[model samples]
Target: MLVHKRVVRLNEKPRIRYGPMLIRDQERIANLNYIYNCNDIEALWMLRMKRAPFARLVQTFRSRGLLQDSIHTSVEEQVAMFLHVVGHNQRLRVVHNTFRRSMETISRYFKQVLYVVGELKGEMFKSPTGRTPTKIRTSPRWYPYFKINNIL
Candidate 1:
């Protein structure tokens, strides 16, 4: 029996489409608008934060020059990409689909926002005084049981 050989064709090249991609950017903006402007409930479901805090974060990123808009993606999109990945414990591929961004784009923005959040830690948190609060210290039920310094 003669063996059949598979023929390889080299004449046809793959076509790269640019028009839909440009349109996708426009759609991305619309999606972002819905996420931020719609309501706090949707924002909470997506970003794990309310609308006010999400807007404040984007504003802070802009005001401090911590992050800037790229030619195609805005700071808001970048932050949303980061938050969606982190807040929901999602992988890069999942966020890529949600934001219509490449994995590299999602990862890059994630890193940038993570660094900026680290920088904000000092302002966002205060050191504990290490002393029991007056309420707990003075309460008869919780005094010695919850005492920080005078535990018997």
Candidate 2:
């Protein structure tokens, strides 16, 4: 009887070149500055908001303590990821590729940003008064079947 044997290596080490590397803070800052310097149209296409409005929104978030930079990522990148996910309805995998972040990190920050926005909902919205003008309210009823309050 003849038998064939297969050999396996037990002492092999995992590859380091295939592992992920941390993005430098300077690179992130430079990318963010370029985006911030873009024209209104370009900014709208990239972030789904005009440059001025986006800056104001970021400022508001910072002022309200709703967002901050993580040790590995900047506030601008986080905000951009959030907006990109929203504007394009992208999947987590796609977001990971665009932001160069792990799926878990992207998801965690996405949810955190959503939570912060929800927390600010009250401050962001104004209650509707549903009031009619005096002229319309005091006007003689042209049609008795129609009522302003009911219509509203």
Candidate 3:
């Protein structure tokens, strides 16, 4: 049987440099700006939810013992990572690059947020009361149709 051997390099550290900037520094700067300076429209596009809604979700989960801020990652950042994964159907590597987090960190928090969100599915998807709005019922075009169907 043939055996495969790996060679270890001595006195060498992984080098990640882009021109004059370091990769880690670039990622940190990008993540910081994206997370903090994003407008509501950008936030909605990125997360598939508005800022207020996302904040509400984070607050609810925090209050329910589902999520908390760790030493390195905050609750908001965790939720954003979760959204970036689910909303965009992105892989962990992409999330790592976008969020400036390690793959392990991205995977861990992704699973955690996913579990908590799944547990809170009932509240998240609560059924409507099936009540029609009065404005819609009273509309000229809708009134005749609704009256014919006895819907109103």
Candidate 4:
């Protein structure tokens, strides 16, 4: 009797193609048109500088264990959601529509994100090393008094 063994080979390298699709081409054209035709400085400012607060909040949340890299939502999306809610002061439904998320999904994301932010606040701000300055209390006798008729 003769026995034969089967050997398996794996592809070590894979090839990838890099190019723009039809949809991407159209989007690029539209973006260029907007840049050329739109004179809205406020819109430009909004696109660039408006996300600072959200970025800070997202950083805080990431620092805490409540947020992890394994989550499906990108940090950018979370930050955008946060900014949309804060800048517009909008309701959850509005935020959901703005972020192009379902209301239930948006609610869940906001709930988790806010919970993480709160945890971060407690962990960071509760200590003196945080941004908040230490509170100081003055003695009653040393408190500054206004002089109405030169009376303490």
Task: Give the TM-scores of the predictions, in the order they appear.
Answer: 0.70, 0.64, 0.65, 0.43
lDDT of 2 by residue, 1-152 (tens): 12222223334565567544435445545666777798998888878989887877778888878898778766667778888899888898997876667899999888987887788889867887776656666667733333647486
- Superior candidate under TM-score, 1 versus 2: 1
Task: Report the lDDT tens digits of candidate 1 across residue range 34-130.
Answer: 9978788888999998989888889998999999999977888888888888899999998888788888888888999999999999986799887
- Per-candidate Cα RMSD to the true structure, in Å, reads 5.5, 7.5, 7.1, 15.7
Candidate 4 off by > 4 Å: 1-56, 69-72, 122-152
Q: Report model 2's TM-score to 2 decimal places.
A: 0.64
Clashing pairs in 3: none
Identify the candidate with maximal lDDT. Answer: 1
Expressed as tens digits, the lDDT of each residue in 19-138 for candidate 4 is 756665465455434533444564333333333444565576676556654354565455555545655677988766555567876777777767666656755465444222223113
Clashing pairs for model 2 are none
TM-score of 1: 0.70
Q: Which regions in candidate 2 have their CA more than 4 angstroms from the true location? A: 1-8, 11-33, 125-152
Model 3 TM-score is 0.65
lDDT for 150 in candidate 1 is: 60
- In model 4, where is the ten-residue run with the lowest total lDDT? 1-10
How does model 4 fare in lDDT?
A: 0.53
Model 4 RMSD in Å is 15.7
- Give per-residue lDDT, candidate 2, residue 146: 38
